[model samples]
Target: MLEDLDALSLRVQRAVQLAQGLQAERADLMAQIQQLQQRCQALQTQQAAERDEFARMSERLARHDLELQAAQKESAQARGTLEIQLHEQRAHAQSLQHSLQASQADCDRLRTAASGAQQQIELILERLPGAEA
Candidate 1:
């Protein structure tokens, strides 16, 4: 009977020890679970921050695109105006060139006519009386 009691007591003690070991293991696992949850939360926060940064950069890119489009429009307008001015200047220069050519032709014609008139007058004077050889 005493031997039976001792065996039963030994089994009880081993069960208690096993229960304690299991409790300790549970505590360690719970701690690990808590740390993993915290790490997950941190990761989520970082993701949120990255999302916000991406949105901000996207907005900046959009604004820059708008600015680029406006600049292109302004540059196109400036180019158009300059082209018009250049065309007018070229037209005016061509007109001036034409006028210069006409004036030069008229001057040459007058000089030739004056030279002919002078020769005719000289011949008439020579044929007249007392005109020397």
Candidate 2:
């Protein structure tokens, strides 16, 4: 009877260990999910800022276009002055446009990366026994 009691106690200890390990793993996974979610939010905010910058750049481009048209119309009276101002404005607009495009591309890339990370986390969670249910 004593031997049987010892065996039963050993089995209970092992079960407890298993449960503890599982709980630890679950906590780790939860922490990872939270960290990933925070990163995703940061990326989303950055994307929004980039989009806003793009909008501002577009507005600036429109204003530059209007200025260019006005400059052309005035060129007949002050050809040299209008031409210089037009060239400068055009150059500035081009630079802003390029910067906007680069920012947009970066935003898209970050969003894609965040999506991939989320998918990987989901996959990991799905593979876990309790998580699947």
Best by lDDT: 1
Which pairs of residues clash in candidate 1, taking residues 3 or more apart in a chain or in different chains?
A: none
lDDT of candidate 1 over 1-133, digit per residue (tens): 9999999999999999999999999999999999999999999999999999999999999999999999999999999999999999999999999999999999999999999999999999999999998
lDDT of 2 by residue, 45-85 (tens): 99999999999999999999999999888876688787888
Residue 60 Cα positional deviation in candidate 2, in Å, after optimal superposition: 0.8
Estimate the TM-score of every prediction: 0.80, 0.51
Question: Which regions in candidate 2 have their CA more than 4 angstroms from the true location?
Answer: 76-133
TM-score computed on alpha carbons, candidate 1: 0.80
Model 2, CA-based lDDT: 0.96
Each candidate: RMSD: 2.4, 49.1
